[model samples]
Target: MDTYLMNERPSYTAYRERFLAAVQRHQGRVSHYEHPLKGRDGETLYTDVAEIGNPDATKWLIIISGTHGVEGYYGSMCQTLYLQGLDLHSLDADTGLLFIHLINPWGTSWLRRVNEDNVDLNRNFIDFTRPLQHNDEYDNIASVFNREAIEPEQRRINEQLWHDRAAEIGETSLRSQITAGQHQDPEGIFYAGQFATWSNQTLRTIFANLPKSCKQAICMDLHTGAGDFGHPMLMAITDHDYPGLEAAKKLFGPWLYTVHTAMGNTSDTGVSASVDGYTSQMLINAMHDKDFMQLVIECGTYSPSMLEHSLRFEHLHYLEGNDPGGHQEPGHSLKSALLEHFFPHDQQWREIAWVRTRQIFDQALVYLRDGQTHY
Candidate 1:
């Protein structure tokens, strides 16, 4: 087994243990922010932040894992792998690395894609001072997600609604509309939540406490379950172009896909473009005074259709008062499928995800250490 893959575990508790051990092995400065919840195994949960090199470094490379909790395994492995191979003495004096592990620890522990409140942390980062972003179109398809049964008739009705909607608006647009994030329905999938979730607040607090000398940083939010199988897509997703966007463009050149999200916008990159309050944008807003480029490494595993099916079934399983990690029949089956969708059991896919993610981190590190920023 590779040293980095040590962090890849069957359960969140094991993964977190491996992560903390790796951090200690590397002598990285660690801070534990406890989550007010327990894991599926009744283990305590936390979002652990580790900093390597000078804490006051002006240039930083921040890599975040587990923004979408079920996807944390991939991110955790990437992080642990990087740490295992990282040489603290060889790092640039002015550059530091920060790893935020399992921001939504509850979801990771429970094998869920959302946080404790069923809030999609990615979509929960919006400004609560103003009115929440409304997805009127999501209401039209809410019934598909609201169903609590996986019976043949129930599944058929839901699938037929999706099919009909796709026929009416095209599959691409249908996907965009369905995933754009909605605030109206707490029970719906991709629920943005009425306010900042614990993960959201915790992330903000982490950003708020960055060393004052930190002026420029390249942040990567690790994710999975979109795009072509075994492919890791590098993306700069934001509502508008920021100072760091051009620098990223030059650094990554054609390798980076720039996504400017807005209402009714679409992208071939397999990410929702119509959504607001993305974590990437939140990072931009948080570090407005600094030159920051927020990037996402979304690894592909299974098709969107497959993902939707898994998500809906698992959601129903959850609604039916069954734990995803439960040993029972339907719950166990649903959990397995959902887990496979986000974090595939396929070995080749896992290898590709880690290799590609490592490459992305390497490039960002080199740029942070030596490359110039537009700011």
Candidate 2:
């Protein structure tokens, strides 16, 4: 694979097959979980899992990609690079590896943050029968994202509204409210959804099938578009502490930042603490019988201001895309801007992201294969 792929358009088939080929090189036991929806270009999509090492191993280190759709470019490439350099023999016989490639196929295919139903897969993990999370602040400003286009005046207005909200409730706190995830708006940005999304269900199913022998597992869900430029934050994100908190602290040391999630929490980690429903939390729930460390590696790009504008623009473009009368697809610049926000074009950015990711994974493999936990 090339170092990076940046554009408004990315071939989901291309990434899927490349990752699949890499998985094949490892001679891992591969299985495909076909997605229900086809790609925007009619491509067959799947979440492919390749299991290496014995199922009855002492630990399983699972790395996942594509939880945020377009963010898959970064994660998928990182997976490929890791496999290319992986000497399977270096892994202890008592440890196994599971590579889950692209859990949200539809989102990746469509270059979107949310899945097929406009559901943010990360936020789609909650039990449907219980009371869902509501963000009234996002509701108040939801209309800002309900625009026909991302024009100069509109940008000014939205920026002003953002400043007002920040003034009223601190910038980071307001950001947590805006992005904390909401279930009320299906068409608006960051919709958590009313029920389990397809990606959510499929991921749970895949987890159930993984080898039950390993009492220790650490899962890293790959993501981009948050934090300082080119800096990948190693995060332990959850509603509360899990079985592996101590192990995680030991594994990553000061590199690890834990955020406790609730309705009114705040964090400078670039991940929302004002919300529930996270990929890490779901995996922690699924593997509760085991000592598990659920971590997220969020690679950063662009300033928060740039991210804000692109996100709203992309949302507008997505809405226009489905109109009966039809709307022009956003120009290359707009598309490229969105992509750059998540997956940058700079060589330094790509190199830095991969290096940090590799370092994290290296430490994790050691943790899974040899690092012991008192818990």
Candidate 3:
């Protein structure tokens, strides 16, 4: 199938075509589940799940991509390339594979992190039984997201305020307050949806339809815009014990890092608060009766400041619209720079990304098929 043909990095439209084409080519063994888009475009973005091996296989390797929309470019590419070259005929009677592509198509098309509703899908999976939780800390920072221009004084004030809060409430508290999922302000950052989003509902449906024959499931959700440049870090999101963490570290060696508590070097205070309804959590909640494990593979692109600047400008451009002049203006450039920062065009970075992803996938497959944890 020349999987590399699926490797050509293209714009949103081209990527969609290549993905659909790949599914068509493998339609004999794969079933496509189409979700009609609710937006005005009337375009239906497909989330294709490909199953191979026995229907009743006890062990399943589930690879999912594009939970964050913009991050799907790398994730979709990995899944497509894998399927393009995968030999379905070589089946392990006890094992199965499920490939879920583009969980959030709107974000992918618009190249944004959130869905059409500005909901961070990762933060959208909360228990509705509770009074819709709000990140009060985020409320204090609402001015940071104000549509006004980023004045030099405002930037200085923000920096000083951040440090002051870090000292007073602690960094973890601050991070938890901000990043912890909130439902009050839909327009604000990391806003967990008031209700299940389309993607959220779709994912629940997908989990329900998972083959009953599968006793164990392994999931890897691809993400970028974190960690070191070009280096893919396999991060653990589950609150599982040391054994599960050790098993993963042993399987992937130094390539993996465990983030059980929000206290490590990579730990930020509000991260836990903002990540209330992560896909990982949803999977765990759905598969409580089954043995399930998952990993979030985050590839770093830019520094904290750069990422913040990029996201801020992108948000500004979307909310304020482009200047009358053109994309060459500062606002447009900021958005462009953010995209490039996360999705670097450099050959070396791309090659490294592909190689590392393949390594992780191959290693995960071996772990799944063997049914043995080696540390």
Score every model by TM-score: 0.94, 0.91, 0.83
Clashes of 2: 0
Best by TM-score: 1
lDDT tens readout by residue for model 2, 92-161: 8988889999899888877777888988898888888888767788866665665522455765676666
lDDT of 3 by residue, 1-375 (tens): 344433454455666566666655655245555655532134566776777666788888888888888788788777766666666665466878787878888777666778877888988886877887656677666656544434646655665656666788876667666766578776666778888888888888888888878778878889887767877777777544534455676677766666653322235311352356778766766776776677787877776652165766676566565451114577546645655766776667766777778777777777887766451
Cα deviation at 362, candidate 1, in Å, is 1.5
Which regions of candidate 2 fall more than 4 Å away from where they truly are? Answer: 1-10, 147-163, 306-308, 322-332, 372-375
lDDT comparison, 2 vs 3, better candidate: 2
Best by lDDT: 1
- For model 2, give the 10-residue run with minimal summed lDDT: 323-332
- State the TM-score for model 1: 0.94
What TM-score does model 3 achieve against the real structure?
0.83
Give candidate 3's error at residue 54 in angstroms.
3.3
